[model samples]
Target: MAQSSDIEWTDATWNPVTGCTKIGRGCDNCYAERFAERWRGIAGHPYEQGFDLTLWPSRLMQPEAWKKPRMIFVNSMSDLFHKEVERAFIDQVFDVMERVDWHVYQVLTKRSSLMRAYLHKRYGSSAVPSHIWLGVSVEDEQHKGRIDHLKQVNSDARFISFEPLLSPLHAIDLRGIAWAIVGGESGPRARPMQEAWVHQIRDACERDSVAFFFKQWGGARPKSGGRLLDGEEWNGFPWQIVPKSIIEQLSL
Candidate 1:
């Protein structure tokens, strides 16, 4: 499925792959899994098989059809690095991203190590495509290693998503990261996020010159708590890596 997204960070979503297993606390209340499961058993439905590992070879060309440029959140419904997804299939996904240079594809994943290994093998000391942004989902201090894994990649378009911020991320380094997005978990079983935790990351970003974006504060629903941090909204973005041509088009 490919369409405009309600996600605050990106303009659209492209799910050439679907379904994933939980790897950590962050996956406990996955909105994507919940949404996909609801349509299970429905005849001819896109999610008829529910949140099972499935690939859409047909949807591989969706982005090429979108003439206008966009910020697409790749695989919002699944992880591109899931063990079930074959390496050859991943090549196809990257191939599409490589071909479609107009759009900015944000590929965020909890499997940071897997993604790092894949990129190392694919690009091998060369930089990844500038428009295809690589990022890792970090929930707390325990997953700090994911950031390190991201830093090892050969790309300038690197970012980190701290959504469902589970605990205080004290003293974590942000030097090599280009962008950071922080938010609390939402939904019925949502976990509470502390003010200090948000500050910890935001301050680190400021000190290290990384872009910081505050997505939400978490509650029964995604927007149950408005996105605010200390009486202000943080909407930092990294525009330094955008190519000159795309920047001109974006201004239009």
Candidate 2:
């Protein structure tokens, strides 16, 4: 995984586990799958097995090695809650995240139900650590239930990503969410995102007081169309959720 990421949101990516199966329409043109497949069958390559669920137990301690605090995106190339992953393994990943403490980890997944169940089991009635911000991906209205699942979790740092935004998510409720990222699909077969669809989300974020971030206006490439929305770039972040210690270190 890269120590630095080009992603506008997080600072770096740490893939303690890699590879995942497609769970929905959002996975149709997965950039992670495309990147991993390119290294398929190449001996000694991290993704030699392609986008097949593989656990990297050795990488569990990667975050601890980094002394500096940063915003780390966990499992960017995979979904940590994939059904194929064992409960014990998931525990190890969480264990590391909890112990590391210094870094803020963004664990995003499309497997909303599984994540909700696991978090309930792991933390019981207590809230998850604020440093470990949990989130879900909602590509359209059909997947709006994911947001509901996220809200059910016992945390105030919940967020949602509407990237590769396929269809209009009309009048979605963003009440419990702290942050929302919206963007169009980017790839060879990228789908066009209507301005009205984005306006709906941005306006709702304002209404619900959720931090809104407009990632990109996707095309053949991520930045091809630019990130301008109403002639301005929206890069809102949930700084309120980040711990004070991390904020102090970041400023240093």
Candidate 3:
């Protein structure tokens, strides 16, 4: 599916890939897997395969058709770097982003090591395109290495999604990160997030000059608890890292 998105950090979503297998704690209650599984066995349903990791070659050019320039979150329903996804397919996805150049793409994944390797092989000595912002998901301190992997990639618009923030991440090093989005889990079994934990991350981002975005203090529903952090919303965006050309286009 390629259309507008409700994700606070992005303007739209383009999923050339769909369905995914759980990789870590953050994925324990994946909203994607849950939603996909609901359509299992219902022939004709997009997720009839039931979160079985399917690729859609037909949707590769979805971004190009939308002439408008906006921040698009690539593969929101799946991980592009999943081991099952062919490297050739990943190349095509990258090619579309390159050709579309006008729209900004945010490619976030929990498969950090593989992502780093792919970036190295694709861009090599050259820097990654600024419009293609690369990011990783960090659920807690245990997955902090994902951040380290993100830092290793040679991209100016590197970001961290501390979503489903299960625990404190005070030790995370936000040095090379341009932006950080923090939010709690939301669903039937949504976990509660401590105020102290969020404050710590926001404080760290401030100290490092990193743009911080506090998405939600999620509960039963995404907006159940509201998105206020200490009486104010943390909507810091990494506008400084946006590509000059894309920024100009958006301004127009």
Candidate 4:
């Protein structure tokens, strides 16, 4: 079963794999790492590696058991495309996704190069499952190259996550993108996110007519900060990709 997530971009989280190590500045204060340490004593805890690279093959079939259609965050506690995760394990993960066509899986990773290489060698362009929405994490200008790499992937739905946003990104080219999710970092040592940064992305999305979702205000504690920009919440998605038939079916 998929666990309902507080993350504004998705409905639920399904960690077929868990545990990851810091790979970039955006990972300086990982919420998943902190959560793992706090719940170390719990049974069946997926984050047993305590921020160390580890894979949990036992969780691969969890989505198959889910009856309803859901937007599942794949590997929320870990990066499925991490270097430590073997190619065989990735195949198993893809196998589960292939079988469970009812659920929409959102897989985001910082390892865009590895992802590109894997997709090219293993699945190629035609093999990217339509139900899977692939995305890359671009926290700063240095990581902006990830956008280009993500564009090369053969996935049907491609997106970008600018969460824990560290700097103002200007002239973002949303050429072949489907959606963009922006949010500030939130934690005890969370960094401050500027209002101008949020507006810049929002404005770009408006101009390009790309789907934009504002996730949070991220402060010392995200809950205390809340997810309000100007006065309302921005939870929009690209309606074009989301078929009208599915919309009608969901409405019923």
* Residue ranges of candidate 4 with Cα displaced over 4 Å: 41-48, 243-252
Ordered from best to worst lDDT, the candidate numbers read 2, 1, 3, 4
The per-model lDDT (C-alpha) reads 0.91, 0.92, 0.90, 0.82
For residues 1-252, what per-residue lDDT tens digits would candidate 2 score against the true structure?
578998999989999789898878999999999999999999998889998889998899999988999999999999999999999999999999999999999999999999999999999999999999999999988999999999989999999999989899866899989999999999898889999999999999999999999999999999999999999999999989999888877521
Off by over 4 Å in 2: none
Top candidate when judged by TM-score against the true structure? 2
Q: What is the lDDT of residue 136 in candidate 2?
A: 99
Per-residue accuracy of model 4 over 1-252 as CA lDDT, tens digit each: 356777767778887667787878899999888887876656676544456666667778888777767778898888999888999999998888878877777889999999899888877557477777889999987889999999898865888999889999878887778899998998999988899999998998888777889988888787677888999989878656653424433211
By TM-score, rank the candidates, best first: 2, 1, 3, 4
Q: What is the C-alpha local distance difference test score of candidate 3?
A: 0.90
Query: Against the correct fold, how does model 2 do in TM-score?
Result: 0.98
Could you list the CA RMSD of all candidates, in the order they appear? 1.2, 1.2, 1.4, 2.2
| Top candidate when judged by lDDT against the true structure | 2
**Candidate 1 residues 1-252, lDDT tens each?**
456778888888899999999998889999888899999999999999999989999999999998878888999999999988999999999999998899888999999999999999999989999999999999988888999999999989999999889989877999989999999999889999999999999999999999999999989999999997889898998999776668666521
TM-score of each: 0.97, 0.98, 0.97, 0.92
Show pairs that collide, candidate 2: none
Candidate with better TM-score, 1 vs 2: 2
